[model samples]
Each structure stands twice: as C-alpha cells, then as structure tokens.
Target: MTANANRLEVAGHSVLLTFGPGLETVAEEIDALWYHLRAADDDGATPQIRLDYALPSGDLPAGAVPLPARPEASYTISGHLTREVIRRLIGTRLLLHAGAVAHPELGILVLVGASGAGKSTASSMLGRGGAYLTDELTIITPGTFALTPYPKPVSKHDPELGAKRDLALGGLGLRPAHEAAAPAPAMVLLLERIRDEDEPEEGSSVTRVPLSEALTRIVPQTSSLWALPGGLATLAELLNSVGGALEVRYREAAELEELLRRLPPAEHAETAEIEPRPGDVVTWEDTAPAPGRIAAVPFRQALAMESGLFLLGEHGAIHLPGLAGLVWDLLADAGPLTFDQLEQLVVEEIGEHPESTALVRGTVSDLVAHGWARRG
Candidate 1:
C-alpha cells in the first residue's frame, strides 16, 4: 500500500492499521498504543495489515463483523491471520504485542510483557524525548523487527500523564483510518511490575535478568503461542534467534526508560566464547539443507555436544566457539570434506595431544550425532 493511503505517521513511518466495526470503539486508543514507536527508522515502510472478523457486527462500523464469543478467540484469529500475512509479505517469523523505541544512534529498546503490565504507559514516557516505534505488537523476522503502528490516536488512562504529553484523543485525531504495520521487533524487554525496589541496579539504572528468565515471561505474552503450527519448538527457535532477553522491574515509566538506556545491545550468544553449562541455552546460526533434506528443525532446540562435539538436534553441525576454529582449519583445504575429513583436520590442527584431541573429537562427534553433518 502507498503512504498516501495511511493517515498516521511517526518519524516518517506510517502507523496505519484497520479494525472492523468490532474494534471501532477502541479505535481511538490505537495511536496511544503506538506512541512509543515514533522514532523507529530502521526501514522506511510501515507494516500493512487487514483485519478479518469471524463475528457479525451489531452497532459497529460499516465493514464491522461479529467476532466469536470464545475467550481469546479474537486474539487468536488476529494473530494467526496476521502471522501468515507477515510471513508471506515480509518474512517475519514472530509477532508480539509489545512496545519499542529507539535511542539516538544506538539500537532500539523493546518492552514486552503481559497485558496490563504497563507496556503502553512505559512506552509513552520513553517517547517524550525519543521516537516511538510501537506500543502494542512487534513483528520479528530474521535481521529486522517491524512495529505495528496503531491506526488510532494516543489514549491515556492516566489523565495526568496524558495531559502532560498534550495527548487528548480528539486533539490528535486519534481515530482508526487505515491498517498499517511497522517493521519487526528487534529486542524484547519483559517487564515485571515489582512492589519493592530492593534490588540495586547493576551500574546501569535498570535491573536486567538473564535471557532464559526473560523468555519465560515473554513466551506467555506472545499474541498466540499454542496456535503456532510447531508449538513449543517454534517458540524455542524464536527465543534462540532473539539472542538476549531480560526482565525489567520498575514502577515509573521514566525510570524504566532511564534504565533501558543504560543497557547494551543484544549480541548473538552463539558467537561468544562463553562455555556452555548445563541449562545454558545458546543460539547457533544454521540453515536448512536442500528442499528434500530432512524437514527443517524448529529454531529453539537446545544445543547439545555429544562427547564434546556440537550439533543442533538431529541435523546440522554447530560451528560454535571452539568448534568453529577446528572447522576453519578443515575448510582450509577447500575441498568437500566429509565428517571424517573434518575430524582428521581437527587431529592435524591440535596434533596428537590427548587433551586437545579429546576436546576436538568430542566436539566433532557431537556435530555428527546431531545430524549436523551427513556421511560423505
């Protein structure tokens, strides 16, 4: 769709979105939902979306349809349909209801949490000086995160905060005009509202939790988890690709923003040299083989090293830290090396030293056992 077709624009990107009459009542609040994503400029285009309803509209808009009465039925339908559309149009793999904003020259800060977890409030506070990417759902694909701009105007539950930002529904023309989606989400910050502020910040004002812990909260907050085709496997892969996850605890929105600014960028933990411990989940970059090659594995499978070799599930070698060095040496020959050829290269690189050989052998064994390498 062309930019002219949309009415809302933030940071030169469109936040246009459409909802059938079923959602007309809440249409005015959509912009407040996306107030935090005004500064996102990773890409110039906004996400395109079309809402299809399964129910009939009673007093809704002209094209309104009624939604099923089942609990979560609307969310399920919206998420599933949107996911398919995003995948086909933009290659996005995950779509989440979250908040996102960018730091001047640095990367964007994403806020993800359960419904009513203060994502919308926090996003607005952060957008005061920065740009807003989104206040609701964020779509994640490989390498990019597109924010779904709320078609409606900003709505503030806290009248005080709303007044502070000059955000009045009628004043900002906060009405649903068209449905437009932003880029996919880049980072995900799982927010946890804490009653006590006992934990001291780690240098930076924000208290950051481990990636795994963050995922526990993030997974549940997703638009629709059980509906995904592969279930947990698909969820796991998404968490793995996201690389870093954190649980943010803060009461005030401004405090949260300050804390987020102190955090660093998310890096691919798979590339790091940190030794993997039990319960340590890491992301490893691997591509599917040919079309006929065994059906593709979901992304979240844990990393396993059999006898010290690394591999992903029942297929593909894991070229991580220590193993990567060995793989580099093997590829030095520039030939189509079989598993055994690669193993031999490890032996040559580390020599006959028992400890080194054992480590290298274990790593290679793990790779083959996991279906990372096919017998040549």
Candidate 2:
C-alpha cells in the first residue's frame, strides 16, 4: 500500500485504489463517490483487488492491475472495479441489472429492467421512503433470497460536462442500505415505461404476470445466469416463493409511492422444485411430431414453469416458450419415444389437430437442428 492508496469495501470485497503520479484530481472524484465505504488506512491486510490509475511510466505497478486509459479516468476506474468484482462473484450469486429498495415489513422489492428503463430513477425516488439497497446492480443469494448491496454512486449523464457523473447517494438526501432496516427478498417488479404525450391522464399500474412470461424477460437481465449451475431452476424457485413476478407500468417514479404503499405483503409459499406435473397441459396451440424415435441431447438439463421451460444444453440456456416448451418437457421426461407416441401424448395434452402432422414434423426438425433433440 502507498501513501496515495484508498481502500473501499465493495460488495463485501476489499478493493484498494492506489493513485499513480499526477492523478490527485482523479482520486478526489473517486473519493466523492465512495467516501462512505472508505476503510481506515491503519489496517495492514492485503486487498483482494488492487488497481492503479494512470501510471506515469505507462507500465502497471507490481501486483496491481492497470486501469484502462480514458479522458475521464475516474469513470473508467469505477467501471473496471465493478466488472472485476462481478467477475469474481459471478457463479456464487445471481446478479441482475436492476434497482432494489427495502420495505420495513414487505421486505425488499426489486425493480428490474434494461438500461434507460428508469430503474435507477425509480429506485432513487423510492429509496427516499424505503431503504436503498442499490441503484445499479441487485445481487441476490440463490435459494436464500438475501441481498448483497452494491450501492455504487448513481451515474447520471451530464450534458454540460459531456459525460456521466457519479453522484454520491448522501448528496441526494437518500437513505443508504446500512442505515435502513434489515430486508429480505419479497417481490420482483418488471418495470415498463409507458410514454404517451396525448394520454396525460394515464397513471401507473401494477399487475401480476405468469411465470413463463416473467422468466423470458427476467433471464436476459441477469449477468450471472450462464456461470451459475442450475441457474434457471434457482430463479424459478425464487419467483414461486415470492408469489411470482409482477409487471409495473409507469409514467414516472414519483407516481409510484401510493401504489407501492398500498400493495399487500408478498405471499411466501412453500419452496417447491420446478417440475412438470403428469397431467399438465400446454394450451399454446402449436402442433406436434410423427414417425421415428426422438430423444433429447445427452446431459441436457431443464426446468419447467407454468407456460415456459428453460433448456440448458451444450450451447447455452434456451427459453422454450408456449408449444415449444411442451415439446421439450415430453422429450426430457420420456425421450426415445416414437414420433407417433409423442403425437399421442400431444393429443392427450391439447387434443389432436388436423394440421398436426406437418406442423409437428416442422417443430421436431427445428429441435434437431438446434441441438436440443435428435433422431434416435
């Protein structure tokens, strides 16, 4: 550690930021953003990650990672630090690009969406009343539903500065996670912003969504899905425990207060493994297959939801929605069945169709081509 070193506790990991010569200004900017997490310099324990900014000799310091060169070195270092932390913890936790706030009684409500979807804005505004867990990344411990806060400064794009500025949470008058009540995973909300200039009277609303539809949208927002073993199954179980996911359509963050406050506490159901029932029917109205034996690719694993299924194959995780999901469940459960037998099962589930012959053939062909199933 050097005289210019500043240590920060980031998501339970210790990171030491050692400033290089002529980087005093960059250090100040970083200090402003993470001052809350700064560790006392007297501690002598080595940090898990030690990064150096703008080394004058253009070479990295011994045992330290050199940050990428950028005009805004402060921002570059912040991004690098966040990525490094995520890289180390990817397989151990489920990381979503969502914002989180904790209610005293209702527990934690996670606001999930893609970038520019106003999750950060919503979290920031809601945090004024609830405990702020995070505004950028929401880290969930699988099965337990415990949250690990990565409360980095909220980055807002500044038109005058021509770059995004990281604003400290304290400066905005919001409560940080440590200062708030202990919270547990309670609800997951899919944020959809409805912008209609002509419909000025429109207000925000929250509605319950089916498991399959929520899985389709929420899976892509996760950064650790591919790395975590049985990730889809874990997520499916979590959704079930919290009484499935909800969709919240809103025009602005300010309008959500009354709606959120009036919402009932999440119903905690018995933890159940996500598997298809014997008599489950998929009414997605898609056709089935004919003739030869069909079996799923070897070593493939899958988890079924209400109307969708996730297949983890040699390629990656695949979302089989609607009719496609039904077909997958059949193959995974009782594969190597004759196409006629498969067709019989499909008929039993959704009844036989006049055009099922060709359509089933097409669906089977697609599965074989995509490495999900093969002719036996």
Best lDDT goes to which candidate?
A: 2
- Per-model C-alpha lDDT, please? 0.45, 0.71
lDDT of 2: 0.71
Q: List TM-score per model, in order.
A: 0.43, 0.79
Badly placed stretches (over 4 Å) of model 2 are 1-3, 55-72, 104-106, 179-181, 197-202, 264-301, 312-318, 333-352, 365-376
Taking the tens digit of each residue's C-alpha lDDT, what string does model 2 give over 40-83? 67478989977766554546567655544344566667678778
Per-residue lDDT of candidate 1, residues 142-178 (tens digit): 3343444432233234454332122433343223212
Q: lDDT of model 1 at residue 59?
A: 46
Lowest lDDT 10-residue stretch of candidate 1: 305-314
Clashing pairs in 2: 288-360
